[model samples]
Target chain A: MIGIAAPLGYAAYLSFFQDRMIGGNVFVGFDNYRRALGDELFRAGLWRVLLFLLVQVPVMLGLALVAALAVDSGRLRKPGLFRIGIFVPYAVPAVVASLMWGYLYGDRFGLVGQIGDLLHVDMPDFLGSSWMLASIGNVVTWEYVGYNMLILYAALRTVPHELYEAAEMDGAGEFRKAWSIKLPAVRSALVLATVFSIIGTFQLFNEPNVMQSLAPGVISTSYTPNMYAYNLAFNGQQFNYSAAVAVVLGGVTAIVAYAVQIRSMRKEQGK
Target chain B: MSVNTPARRRPRRASNALTIAMGLMLLYALLPLIWLFMSSTKDSASLTSGFGLWFGHGFHLFDNIGDVLSYDDGIYLRWFGNTLLYAVVGAGGAAFLSTAAGYGLAKYRFRGRTALSAVVLGAIAIPGTALAVPTYLLFSKVGIVDTPWAVLLPSLVSPFGVYLMRVYAAEAVPDSMLEAARIDGSGEVRTFFTISLRLLAPGFVTVLLFALVATWNNYFLPLIVLSNPKWFPLTVGLNQWNSLATGAAGSGATTTNFYPLVITGSLLAIVPLVVAFLFLQRFWQSGLAAGSVKE
Candidate 1:
């Protein structure tokens, strides 16, 4: 009962009157929800995060899968070195990584600036309004591809030798083997990585928050839902509304993640 | 084995192409780091002189390091020390607590085991940032704001660590061993610490590394909790510097090189993490493989 009650009680407490509980206000049934849906910033934040999810998740996961498969192939002589190199960024604190990239993206004193001068061409401003999202995506991809790769690579290693041997015996090419055997074998891991990525995409904070200094005009307070919620709670002092936004964002993530899981499970059953 | 020798030759060509592509990918991964290294050596004047990646005439690496360390009465060192304390204590405590909690969940068929597991899974899915506001409010109500305890407490309850420990404990610790220990008159604590804990070494290391990295890199929690710069972690400290630099840039301050200090500080911040990775990479790789599904 303690085990069950501890978590459930926390959830109930948070969901029931999280706003009033935090701010000592009267209960407003679904008014917070209505406010969240009506807020243009909230809607824009959701759309921006969803767009990020659509583009970044696939590219990041694909790169991770490719790197993992490459490292697992045993063809690379120094796979450990490459693995460690790729994984190094995961260790660097996100704020610091953002600063580093911020400098690299700097117009005047950055590497890009220096290279542009050398080539006698104008360097495209990475932190410009049109490119800020993609710039942030680049940083995210750099930080996480190696991490997801490690997971998928670990999963790849668990594929039985007999399966590969059988594939080879049937004159299956490497691509065919990867598609028919390797991909199917690591399906669960791919799903796990994708789900993890989706959750992570919504939780985007440190990168944009840090990069905000570099591109103030580009990244608004509502660049992502997390940032928007943060600004609302702290800057706007609207804790009740912020909590409402958080609840809605959390609900969206949970629903989408659950749907993905259910759909994948159904596909597996069909197979 | 020799069934596809000709096809194998074709794969060799494909493998060569793969290796080249992987090499390029590795270089891409290292480019920003290389840029950081190069930029740290240059003076302020040369910072924008179209030689950012190349070595400048003024080799002020030591000067920059000195400046970063000495800034604000050696506040960077204080931040560094606070970060170390947080990482060591917070992650250490988290690993032990999660291990115990995971052992309880995995080894015992308790009344609400499934419910507990589900709660943990849900917690794992809930982003840490999502809880930051509530956590801050709770801590403030208790008047623990700006205290290390605020950061330390939240760091202790990593739901992902708990989940990983549970999965690892299930895989690494045998049920029969627990029964045998019980039959041999061992206490539950003794069985856990002596037999189960020892067996779970790899998993423990994995959890320790994960927790350490998470706590060490943690910015938002510390950012929200600690208003005092003295209590800041490297992430917050560097960000404060970045913000100050932006202000300086706005004022058009033609001063001695703040650029080098930022670069050098960034480099120093990365060193400990790099060292941790190098020292723990072997254990991490093996632990990851072992703690996951077996081949």
Candidate 2:
């Protein structure tokens, strides 16, 4: 409670007031929240992350699902190698992953630049403003797909072999068994991954923040909500407003995640 | 016999196709790492000039490693040690606390148990970053900001770890076993320590690994809370080095780039966790499955 709840309550309390240059800390009613809601930078960050959640979450999860099913199918050669090979990236820290990808995306000094040089073609800039979010998404998907795959694969492993045997006896094909038996068995795990991804998406900071130096012009301090709050409190000395932003972000995350869980539960019941 | 031959032949073809597809995915995953390895062996000049997917004219791997380990009064080594300390004490303590609390929640009926569980569940939903600013403010008031406590104290609380352990304990530890231990005159704590802890080992490892990775990969909390270079973890420190390399480090700009050192340090920073995962992945996967894949 001290670790989790106390700070949350404190942040909530802090959100209702403003820290000022001359007045010090003073109660401002809902003025801070009013500012947060009206803050263009905060809203833009939120919209960017929502777009990220929509596009990146599905791509990463879809890759994980396919990897899990492929591994569970027992048809791939050296499945363990494939599993571990893909999973090795999960062990790499996000800072390192971002740095590595940032280096790779550099049009002047990166691999893509060299490849473009060799081909005598103008390569698209991965770190350009238009493609920056996609580049970050690629890094995230690279780091997490294996972790999610492991979750789904572990769930797949728990499905009783007898069920598959029964299905086989009923003349079910590989695709059919996987579709009906395996997918349903892993629905809860899928939902868990989704919720985790949703939380991760809202908390998106490390990749973009670390890569900020590589593309300073493109990634402003308010690139993401967390980054915005950090910069607000630390850089702008707007602690109260930062707290309000944090609270709003936290509230949105909890609501979206809770909605996902509730919807998944309802769907499970309907089935 | 004809039907059997076609069925067998079809699966063989499918298997080959599946293998090829998995191979492609494997390449996609490994390419960056391979690039990291390949590029880290080059001198700074060759880093940009040489082909990134292959080696430079001469190998400078050892020189880069030496520079990374020894540069700036061996700050990289200090960050490595800091990361080690934070991950060990933070993750180890979290797993222990989670195990005890989870067992208590799973086995014992007490006042406010439901409330406590609900709080944990709610905490799990609230992204950690949201609380980070408040935590920093609270710590600042308490005079722990810019100190290791700022990082370590928050790191110790793993709500998901507690939740996972609760789920695992409810299934793995039997009330009958506790009853038997009590019949033999074991106190509640003794029964828990001596009996239930054994049953929860896999779950313990699972929570430990998760907490371990989280602490190791942690960046934002430390970045916000700690301003002292002496207290910086590898993630923050390496990012600092990266900025320096790119001539982006605020106000203290140096013309000398740290690309080789940064790349080499990154590779070194990841080695321990990668080795740990390679050795102990099965335990983590199985434990996670048991804890999470509940109906």
For model 2, the stretches where C-alpha displacement exceeds 4 angstroms are: A117-121, B1-14, B251-256
Query: Using Cα atoms with residue i matched to residue i, what is each candidate's TM-score against the true structure?
Result: 0.93, 0.96
Evaluated against the true structure, the overall lDDT of model 1 is: 0.81
Model 2, retained fraction of real contacts? 0.79
True-contact fraction per candidate equals 0.49, 0.79
Instruction: Give DockQ per model, in order.
Output: 0.48, 0.64
Please give the RMSD to the true structure for each candidate, in Å.
3.3, 2.4
Give residue A213's lDDT in candidate 2 (0 to 100).
93
Tens-digit lDDT track for model 1 on B1-295? Answer: 3564443222332367777898888887888888888878877777667466678877878877888899889998998999999999999998898889988898999798998889887776666555666666777888999999988987788777777788888888999889999999999998988889998888788889989999889988898788888799988988878877776336655444556777788888888878988888778887776544331
**CAPRI docking class of candidate 1:** acceptable
* Cα lDDT tens digits for candidate 1, A51-92: 999999999999999999999887776788888888889888
- Residue-by-residue lDDT tens digits, candidate 2, B47-128: 8787888999799889899999889899999999999999999999999999998888899999999999998888889888
